[model samples]
Target: MGNYEQFHLIVKWKEQALMIESLLFLFLNIILSDKKQPVSSTPKTYIYDT
Candidate 1:
């Protein structure tokens, strides 16, 4: 029972971490895409522009 509880807690922590990581990744992608526009000389470089 103790081992099971520990496993559950670890799983919960991992899920929260993954969520945070994904959010950060999305933010970075947006920032990077914006930065690329000025350097690339292309008009439609924004990925999430749909």
Candidate 2:
């Protein structure tokens, strides 16, 4: 078997690796990204007093 044949076999695996990387990148962003938005504090009396 030549190196290209080995490379061809590896290429299929590389696609799975690329997909995993993309999903991990997306998940990390969703979980760790500091979404730039103003946070509003709700009035304490509304819920706390009840």
Candidate 3:
């Protein structure tokens, strides 16, 4: 019973860690995509100006 309890605790910890990592990954992706979008649009504006 004690070993089973320990196993459950470890599993819970691992799940929490995975959740945090995925959230961080998603956050970074959103930030990077936003940064890229503006930079990408800048070229079109420059071409129109020229």
Candidate 4:
């Protein structure tokens, strides 16, 4: 019973960690996309011109 409880706790912690990591990754992606937006548009314009 004791070992089972510990395993459950570990699983819960692992889930929380994954959630936080995904959130952080999403945040970084948003920031990066925002930064790249202007540069990315230039390529699209070029593509349209061609």
Candidate 5:
């Protein structure tokens, strides 16, 4: 096996690691935004002023 060559698996792992990191960042932003700001929870009636 002296002539055998080694295949690089680092590239594959690195790609996966980067993808997971981006997803985690997005998830954290979503979680934090929901806590800091709240969207409308109910519908509002429009009032017309003459």
Candidate 6:
């Protein structure tokens, strides 16, 4: 029973770590996309317009 409790605690800790990591990843992606979207898309639009 003690071992099982330890295992469960480890699993829960790992899950929380993974959740935080993924949330950070998603946040970074959103920030990067916002920064890149205008810079990347404007050139294409200008080229097409010209």
Candidate 3 TM-score, C-alpha based: 0.68
lDDT of 4 at 47: 21
Candidate 5, pairs of clashing residues: none
Per-residue lDDT, model 1, residue 32, is 79
Off by over 4 Å in 4: 37-50
Candidate lDDT (C-alpha), each: 0.69, 0.60, 0.66, 0.66, 0.56, 0.66
TM-scores of all predicted structures: 0.64, 0.51, 0.68, 0.69, 0.56, 0.67
* Per-residue lDDT of model 5, residues 5-46, tens digit only: 222466667677877876776676578668985434542222
- How far is 36's C-alpha from truth in model 3 (Å)? 0.5
Question: Lowest-scoring 10 consecutive residues by lDDT in candidate 4?
Answer: 41-50
Clashes of 5: 0
Write one digit per residue (lDDT tens) for candidate 6, span 1-50: 99999999999998888778767766765787788753343322222111
Model 5 TM-score is 0.56
Q: Which stretches of model 1 miss by more than 4 angstroms?
A: 37-50
lDDT tens digits by residue: candidate 1, 1-50:
99999999999998888778767766776787788744345543343331
Candidate 4 local lDDT, 1-50, one digit each (tens)? 99999999999998888778767766765787788754343432222211
In model 3, where is the ten-residue run with the lowest total lDDT?
41-50
Tell me how far the alpha carbon of residue 39 in candidate 6 is from the true structure, in angstroms, after superposition: 13
* Candidate 2 residue pairs that clash: none
Model 5, which residues run further than 4 Å from truth? 1-7, 37-50
Candidate 6 vs. true structure, TM-score: 0.67
- Candidate 1 clashing pairs, residues 3+ apart or interchain: none
